[model samples]
Target: MTAEDLSTGHTAIGSDPALDSKIKNYYTPARIIGTDYTYKHKIVWKNAIGFLILHLLALWGLFIFFTGGVGIKTALWAFFILFISSEGITIGAHRLYSHKSFTATPLLRGILLTLQTIAGQNSMYIWCRDHRLHHRYSDTDADPHNAKRGFFFSHIGWLMSKKHPYVIELGKRIDMSDLEADWMVMFQKKYYYPLYALFALFIPVWVPVQYFGESFKNSLLVCYFFRYLFQVNGTWLVNSAAHLFGTRPYDQNLQPVESWFVSWLSFGEGWHNYHHTFPWDYKAAELSMHFNVSAIIIRWLEKIGLAYNLKTASTEMVAKRIIRTGDGTHYALGNDDAKARVTAIGPLHPFNPSYTTKYEAPGANLNDQGLPLFHEMDVINVNNKNIKRNFTKA
Candidate 1:
């Protein structure tokens, strides 16, 4: 379909009138109803096989001791990999690359890229492309991982399923010029597969054996397989658990929520409600930094001159958003006194350099047709333009 057809919600497209009519009957660009005639189980074989292997390896973790006990050193190394690699997604992919919440120096950017590669998530370019689509379409059929599809589908099923046609079609609307222009992002995408094997697969197993004198079998099963599985599920929880449960103080209209349990697992990316509400916020939360390691690391980078131009919603901006759309689950939602207290909270830290003198409240912008665009749609388009300008300046 042409951009005009999609914008007008016209079901028909293409040059041939007969073919367009047949296609229109099969698919409607309006909205995805899982029960629609077009809906079908499109299995992604490679992802299915990979996921099956990972799950079996996770089960093997139970019998790891009986197989051959993993040493304390090996287990510790596995845990370390788990945390850092997961942060690579939460900090590198989500906060930095996808949202452009903070700018990183070349050296720091390289380190984050390395860690993200080791995490085994796709290259930053691919991850950001899918992520922007997710935010733009949200619970609609076009969302790459639409939560409305159900917990399992939203969590990992989308990865193992054939991507919906709308996902591919609408994804093209997202301007990726910024990501494409980045030398580092493009380089990573160009060499993603080989780099993934070298960093994610080989290094994890090789380290325990070469440095810790671990048996190859034990290292492969425990440090490499089990650790990789843990990190994958932890990241998945932010998409599943965070979306389906928890409090929605920021915006009840959005499906995403805040879950402390998910926060701990995701290394502080559990503030989903606020994240969907204010995607540009560096912290991804309106309140405490206690659970947000991503924000902390960005702050530290700012201090060392490795990160800059960190974006965050101000107290007034956050308060206005909550008061307008909050579900009253937040303590600061109702009373004037409570709201004041929330606003009174200081910057992330005393020395934090990421502060904004003016706050721009998140909202929808109108299309040429005069209807307001969805917040996510506005975000993707607007952010791309801003990042492109920044890239040119840099």
Candidate 2:
């Protein structure tokens, strides 16, 4: 296949930021093409240049500082900043805002938003808008970072080009009504640039220099630029590495897979198969949160009354999925032959009687409209009748 075919077969044309100001009028008629929905090529030079600059800065920082005698303190600061910034994307942008897996208190929300700014991804509003669309239309042309488009394209090239028209077209259909209602989310979008520079750039550099007497040059390179680069790459891995390199356990029909290496970098978001299978689950993985620092933080927030209404898939539901749609690549679970036969995803989670009773009555998990509760990633196929509900052993 050619590069464009390898890169998800998407086309962009006639770049203009003005069209993006309002979703309804977003489409430019000139950009629209044949019945198959293809368009000509158009690159967004600003985003392309921005990405180039970031890469150059990261390389310069690594070469000059590491080879030219940077202090140990500065290196540690870079490491610490990477972890915190990754959490800002994984927890704040992905789990909290995009999935709504759990409710956060205003205090916790404020903290996450501040950390998100420090992470230097865009405001949560804009981030979630694209993310929700990606999950809903994954692997298709509508997906902003569709993995079928190849690694480099999905990883960073999507941002470097003008969005495919289908992105704006199908993207506008996603009900952003909920997002429009949140003043805090809106406030961040309104003042995103200023906040990003202050929180993401200034504070990181300021902290090491002010507290530990580090040189501004070393602090800027190690703490700010390099740290930002690390977090951005980690975030990109969810769309690229997790989808391309890992095993698909939850649903082989979907392209997303569970990648341990990516989970380590992104703070627990690399369980792509489980995540795509059960997007409403706060933990994202079927197993424990041991590898998922984001889930652990959410639990801690729950204990301190900063989070509530944490959602998780029933043991029966996950087990059923493993047996049916799973690619047979997960961990074994339980004494039951039926569950154990297909437990190829992760460590088995024991079923909770009370939790099961609360949400598993006939049509229990359905929404008010009698449709299954759908998140951006999950697609429920409830036609199978031989679902084994027992998950007591592992």
Candidate 3:
């Protein structure tokens, strides 16, 4: 979390002197944890209004569905789109990209990226960056969705509220050179506005309305708006419900928990205690596809040879940790782990300081391994060097 903590083990990113200068010269020192870190809860009115409108439209969408206006095929189509879109975040952004729990070919990456775009989340680069921040500095002022702040804050209020100062600064400390090296990720980022519209909004609705003989109004509400809110909230449940209301059977000290309901809703990402405990495990849980649709889809992709290098923790590893920290039964307070973690101690991803140049880089940790990197996050350094070289040349 300290500047020194981030700077270690990282080589220069872009080979261009000017670019390196730009990054090194920019950094502002700031307090990590104190009363000053508190903010007045500024509301992002633009997003708030948009969400309000979407919720209203979703109500209409629900009304029509229950009243028999939507057909079975159209309903199924909406759900299908919803599934693919959610996968983009779960399998694509969260597991594949952020955690590096698995690797994907360009083809699989394209498919996941397309599905994620349909979900209407931010571009994968931004999504991965924020997720990395959430893990490395979890349950602190820096966590994008700190559950300690409250269920509402972690669930959706964080989005409507202006970002806390540390959230913005600590985010820059995350290592994202891997994403920068991805052609598809950069392509989507470069053209995210149109891509989000065409894929997330336009294409999804167009497919059903054009081919399924669905009405525009009905399809628009049911397929796009309502489905979007539902999908986003499903992802949010991992941030909110999983954190607040489940059993930390794996590690009773951490805030994350194992919630079967959240797992079902978020497509297997609700195994919170297991996930935080063994983050590199590709399954996100001990069981692979049981109640985890994302793991099922990932296994299918592996069968097709589009995914590889899937990482996971061993039974031996889990058993040792469980005996050391958990009873493998349920979460309870007043345990040894809890008393030790009374303050929930962790590495601080404070803002980087000591930039001697004029232009301030976004404070990207040239060495920031995005999140904790656990037992994984390691990749082909040779490829990164080549990519950064090419990037500088361009």
Q: Model-by-model lDDT, in order? A: 0.72, 0.69, 0.73
Tell me which of candidates 2 and 3 scores higher on TM-score: 3
**Model 3 lDDT tens row, 274-369:** 898877667888776566988888878888999877766656667667767653453232245433332211431111111011111112122222
lDDT of 1 by residue, 65-132 (tens): 44657888888888888888988898899888887877888898898998999898889988888887
TM-score of each: 0.77, 0.75, 0.77
RMSD (CA, Å), candidate 2 to true, equals 13.2
Ranking by lDDT: 3, 1, 2
lDDT of model 1, residue 91: 84
**Residue 200, candidate 3: C-alpha displacement in angstroms:** 1.3
In candidate 1 the C-alpha lDDT for residue 183 amounts to: 95
Clash pairs, candidate 1, are none
| Residue pairs that clash (backbone atoms under 3 angstroms), model 3 | 1-348, 1-349, 26-360, 175-368
Q: Model 2, range 263-381, lDDT digits (tens) per residue?
A: 77777888887997787677888875457988888888888889877777767778888778766555663224323433223443322111100111111111111111253233222
